[model samples]
Target: MILALYNRQLVEKRSDEAIFNELKERSNYIENDIQSKLLEKNKISLTNIFELTGKDLGISFTIYDNTLQIFNSMDQYYKAGIFAERINPQVYYNLNYLSFREYTIKENIEEYVFNSFYKKISVDNKNYILAVNDAFNKVRLTFSTSDLDVLLFGIYLLAALIIILISTFLADKISSPIRRLTKATMSVAQGDLNVSLDNQEKGELKDLLDGFNLMTNELKRNQSELAELEREAAWKEMAKQVAHEIKNPLTPMKLSIQQLIAAFRDKNKRFDEIFEKVSPTILNQIESLNSIASEFSRFAKMPSYKIEEVDLANVATDVINLFTDEAVDIQLEINDQLPKISADNSQVRRLLINLIRNSIQAGASKIKLLINHENNFCNLVIEDNGKGIAPEITDKIFEQNFTTKTSGMGLGLKLAKRFLDGIGGDIQLIESSKPGATFKVTFPISQKNSFI
Candidate 1:
């Protein structure tokens, strides 16, 4: 019984596949015929195919200008009726057997020949059409209604059983690998990088699984590298601050030692000469101490912000005015319609001052401060005509106490950057031209509080 059921299901599947294949071939044939007819010099109408060819050949067919409608009719039992109408309402054909004249179709026009009747033709009740394929053309001598009922009932039950079995088999075949893959993915997500899913049965799923595993491994490696990079950046920032803080005190100490050596060499210089030398050195040291104290104080203090809408162009004008009398020429290329930004006025002023000073020190003859807006952020670009910073040290320039100058505390740019950060702004040394460095600062549109 099981074997029979399996066979029934297999047969039903084969029949379905065959039906689809036949319909596809028929559609292709119709398309080719239509194209051929179009190429012919004669006036060829597809409608005539039904009237002339189908009727003459005793084959049921309906021709329509639309391919889909014609194909749909062929799959339905309505093809013959539609064919009759298309050909002519009077033309009709019927299939008859030798012994039993079971069904009769009456026609107004005699367009069909008796055409030796076959007794064992297979009928497809699903489509309400006869399968005229060469493999199933054997004519049945007779059909008994009782026998037919029994045969149909058993065939239907068997086909149902077969389909259930095939479905179960396919489900298991497809789901087993998928279940395995899901488990492996869960393990990976839970931090198990060593999990393996090497199902190499050679199909699309296998390739996808392989690629997924490869991607996971690459991501893991990148994550490790990123962690290392972050650690390095933190250390660099810390070292910068420490060096700058230490150098402040060290500069004055060096000057004091130089004065002591000068006093030792001049015996006749008298108390005034020695006192004068020591006094200037002491004052220098005190100044250095003050600078160091102030810088550290600023670093340690948390700023209070007072954010307000301020025009950037006016701010640039004020900052540039500080260097007006200097030998260097400063230019403001502020956008005429630059938007007012919600930022701390004091912090913006300090940031601009530091940046401008850096530009002047960088040997810029003409510093251009360009203000603009981009992607909802306010952009400030400071360009100089001084010697540009070396490409190698560009990234480290923001570090505390890291400077290329012989004088002054190196905390100017670093403090400016931190101040900007406090106000939810970012600063970057964008590029340097032949003259000097270009620094770009971006401030977010929405500032929660003003900078103090």
Candidate 2:
């Protein structure tokens, strides 16, 4: 519709301008021809000058004498004598004042019916008013609401539809590769490092697909290498820790045995007493070795996640009850109607116990637990007035066997992170300006209750 309107407007303007220029040029030529003939010492009239064209001109004219008298006339096309009763006073008025060039177009009631252009021209001091009009009385068809315009409009609509289809085809062709690339990227993110795409189309985009395939290949290779290196390093660390810890008790046990042997050789009457004193030392050292093994075994071989709807508030309450008799002050703040999360029941309990125990052992006098919802996850914020973790080790605090104090296996927060990972949750140590440690544990809300 818009195109049709624009085309119509353009054609209308062109037609009007063509007609105006044609009329102006033809009238100027006729006037100059007459003036030139008069300048040539020829007794030429307007009719003889117009006939000199030797062909039928598309202009009709009448020349007026000094008193506005019709000196001669010729109608090569039409509108020949219509101006006999109508001549401009301006031409005579201007001619009287010796200003000879006066011109104007007199319009008919209809736009394209007729237009007569009259002018005052003087040649060799001979003055006259020259009235000229178009030879072709052609009426331009209306631009709006015509049968031809309707046909053109139909063609315009057809062209528009064709363009739409072509562009749509091109868009789909362009976006198909991008869509595949996006999906492949998501696969890599989800740990499928072997993802790769075929370069179906040839363009600059082929380079993009090739680059993606190369990147994934490198990632898969690098990940395999990293895994092998990590396994070797982990085994080495574990072996060293086991050997050092076992050697601790083994040394004391060997010392106690030496003391027993001395007593036996001396025939000491207190040999039985010496044996009794050293026996507990040997048993205690054995027990320490067993404890060390058990902790490492648990850390290395965590159980598979048993996902279930677990009320976190209830789990936290139960874990809090276990440490209620301790010196540390425990404060629990929970919503009255707390949402349940999808996680292993036992893991939730253990996670809470581990964090609370950490706060107590950190010399915290007061511990705060705030349970709330964040988007599609449950946020369990644990704040403690303990000595905040040293900034240097904060980044490594989540690693297996990483710790700051002299204690048992450093697996509390590591276990928490593992459990959260299994349950599509997360744990982070919040950085605070205050003098206490803050940990935020996130558990995904149960799928049935969560919107996303």
Candidate 3:
């Protein structure tokens, strides 16, 4: 558009210097001819010469000698016609000097502008102003831009096409990396530490893509190190707990057996009575030792999940039924139509039992289980009226081997969380307004459950 405007501006505003040059060249060519004719004392008429060169006033005419008897016309009364069409008389004013002027002529009551050049020439030693005139209509007609519209349209079309092609190419290159980054981020958020991106970009984006790959690698490495540290800590803790529990049962069993051996050696009359008493204590201690071993074994190697469509309401009811004879009143409320979730029935039961057992253990007299369906999820809210968890130790509830209880390894909630994660489910402790801990568990309504 700018180029077109510049071209139009340059063409329309042609300078007077350019017009004067054309007029000067035309007049100079005729100046020598006019002088030669005058030296030969021949009568000069421009009509025959102009007729050969052009057809219109082509406005090329010479007013020589200032007699102003200017033209030779084939028509008989040409002088009268010259008077009818007006020409500026200023052509004769600066008769002895070479000069340039613009003048208007009236032909058929319409005004036409003409450019004139006046040259002083020596013809027979008399000063003659040879005047040359150029018509404005002639210049406008010659340099008019007729096909500028088509030219500008083509330029704009080409510009738009180039812009679209370049933009599409750039968008394709940029979007591929963005999509990969988005998917990789989601994987990391879901605890998948194996996500990484292929760096296939250039320039600043290449740096960005490569940086994302590096970040994921660092995250994966950090996660592995963290898991290793946690395993070491867990082993140390488990060893201490096992040693402590085994020592408890072993000390009592050893004392009871020593008493039985001493009684048998002495042949005491009440030795049978001592043996009976010692045998019961020894059996009970053995049972306690077995229970501790079983608990630790369950924690060390959790049962594999068997994914199946399970009715959560039924499972909750069954778990609640087992506690029917207890002092606590376990109330169940269905807020909406419950949806079956894809999960292991046994794990779901265990998870619910652990939460309810914790509530009962905490002295909850009234326990409430409200199950509902919320977009794409089935949520079970277990709220109780017991002594709530202490504020200081609340964060450690779901951590393995962490517990405020005096007995049992605190594997219940941790294993529950691990199971839920396996089936694309989740459990959270809601900050309660009442006096007991509230656990809200969410089960995804639709899941392609896959886990190790």
Candidate 4:
């Protein structure tokens, strides 16, 4: 619309012939100026009228007759006859006669013809058509689709960033509780039945949170009931052990007294011999009962651990040396640098003695005591080539009053474990079903001054 309005204004201001003559005169002046400048510079080169025109008004002017004369930032000339052959047949036919036409063609021609429209011009009684073409590149500033494309891309990128940020925030908001529940589930799996979750939301997540809380509550209740049942069972087992142990001594004591009463009633001469024999037997039974009572009392009133830096290797050596004359072959393997551990020296020695004696009682021929330091812990591994503990009874080996031996009060391993636990150490049966039972005791290495 702007171009048509501009053409109308130009047509109104000057007649077709006058506008044509003016353009021809301007072209002549441009050529003359270029020739003069070239002569002044002592060079033979055509002036780039296109560049000159673009720099000024950004318009290209062309005149066509038997040849085409084109002028723009890049000045070039072409023969109309040759250019016509390369152009579309219809466009060439339209432009072929435009230069010689006597009147204007109002309609704009096709794109191949430089967006040209025909107008009649007379100079010295000869007529020609003045062609005008729009050259946007001649202009310094212009809008293009590529600029719009860049703008749209920036807008889309901003939109995508906003969406991503919003999505991330929503995801965190939605999954935060689930993540907490997942962590709580992990704690539950690790035996933390006391865990509970908060229900702060008002949707499905809230329902999930409530469910999780209920589940944990149920687990806590079940764990409490189970612990109570276990305590009761343990007490019952202890009662049975106590009754059985007391019965062993009581039956013999009662029998001896009955025999003494019977001998007194018989009025027999051998009564004194019987009394002597029965008296010793009664005393031995009483001593056995006393020993059982002492064991129970010691277990009930276990001493608190007096934590001090004690050389573990020294304690192990002392225990091993005590059994030098025993039938078992005991070997102590001490590392070059054994760390002292924080424990009661007497308790450590007692633990070792009990373990060694148990191995000997198990008919072990070879006992290996390995002492070493690893990862800030003093490790004492005792291995015995004894009849390995049966798999069924291995779990009960550290339970108080649980024993396979007939002579013992059955608190050796249990007391050893309790004593170690008191000093922040632990004892474990590494492999009981192997050729030899292996026991591993670990104590945190002491950093204080050592009582080696």
* Cα error, candidate 2, residue 372 (Å): 20
Clash number for each model: 18, 0, 0, 4
Sorted on TM-score, highest at the top, how do the candidates line up? 3, 4, 2, 1
Residues 1-452, candidate 4, lDDT per residue (tens digit)? 35445644554444434444544444445444444554565443333433444455434544334233433233332333323312233433555644334222322234432223333333224433344433322222133334545655677789889999999999998887777777667545544444456678888998988999888878767766786799799678877887899999999899999999998999978999999999988999989989998887766556556778898887777666656545679999987587678887777877787787788777799999998888878899999989889999988999988999764447678988888776678999999755689999999888664332
Per-prediction CA RMSD (Å):
24.6, 19.0, 18.1, 19.2
Q: Model 2, which residues run further than 4 Å from truth?
A: 1-110, 114-152, 186-194, 264-269, 302-452
What digit string (tens of lDDT, one per residue) describes model 2 on residues 219-328? 86786678679979988999999899899999999999999999999999999999999999999999999999999897676646778888999888766765544567
Better of 2 and 4 by TM-score: 4
Identify the leading candidate in terms of lDDT: 2
Once model 2 is optimally superposed onto the true structure by TM-score, how far is the C-alpha of residue 255 displaced, in angstroms?
Answer: 1.3
Between the candidate structures 3 and 4, which one is better when assessed by lDDT? 3
Better of 1 and 3 by lDDT: 3
Candidate 3 Cα outliers beyond 4 Å, as residue runs:
1-143, 146-153, 160-164, 167-183, 301-452
Worst 10 residues of 2 by lDDT: 71-80
Residue 23 lDDT, candidate 3, scale 0-100: 71
Off by over 4 Å in 1: 1-302, 446-452
Best by TM-score: 3
